[model samples]
Target: GEEVAQTPKHLVRGEGQKAKLYCAPIKGHSYVFWYQQVLKNEFKFLISFQNENVFDETGMPKERFSAKCLPNSPCSLEIQATKLEDSAVYFCASSHELPNQPQHFGDGTRLSIL
Candidate 1:
């Protein structure tokens, strides 16, 4: 079984600062996903990648959120000019490229904006 991993378990940023997150997808997995949870019941899919190419990004905000799943490096998600509304728990997940395969998730990084 492949396991996803995330760095910086906790992040704190002042308003207008930048916030960056790192994710390591499970070995052998071809699909990578990022999600944001602002409220307990609200989990928003942010982006996904197939190998090093972006596959889907239906939920990512064009201006403030950006992500990369580059080969030979940890996948990264960044938010520029952070605002209080950006505070949330960011999750990284990975799965096989095959359709319907379950995604494995890492413990999220909690981002706090002040």
Candidate 2:
């Protein structure tokens, strides 16, 4: 099984401050993904990268949310402007670029707005 690693178990930010989360994709895996859980039942896929290139970014917000999966570096998801509604758990996932290969998720980083 693949392992996805996320840093900073919790994050607290003031309103309008920037928030950043880091992720290390599983070794030998080239695909990385970021998801935001703003509610108990809501999980929104933010972005996905194949190796160092963005693969799909269906649900990412154009202005405030950006991510990078760079070679020889940990992938990063950044929120340019934090708001009360942006407080949530952010999950990082990784998988091989094969059909039916399940993505492995790390323990989410809980973000709080102050």
RMSD of each: 1.1, 1.4
TM-score of each: 0.96, 0.94
Q: Over 4 Å off in model 2, which ranges? A: none
For model 2, how does the per-residue alpha-carbon lDDT over 1-114 read when each residue is reduced to its tens digit? Answer: 357889889999999999999999889898898999999879999899999999999989878888898779999999988888999999999988767899989998999999
lDDT tens string, model 1, 12-33?
9999999999999889999999
Off by over 4 Å in 1: none
What number of backbone clashes does candidate 2 have, counting pairs of residues 3 or more apart or in separate chains? 0
**Model 2 TM-score?**
0.94
Candidate 1 clashing pairs, residues 3+ apart or interchain: none
- Report residue 51 deviation for candidate 2 (angstroms): 0.3
Please tell me which predicted candidate would have the highest lDDT against the true structure: 1
For every model shown, the clashing-pair count is: 0, 0
Pairs that collide in candidate 2 are none
**Cα distance off (Å), candidate 1, residue 94:** 0.2
lDDT value, residue 68 of candidate 2: 91
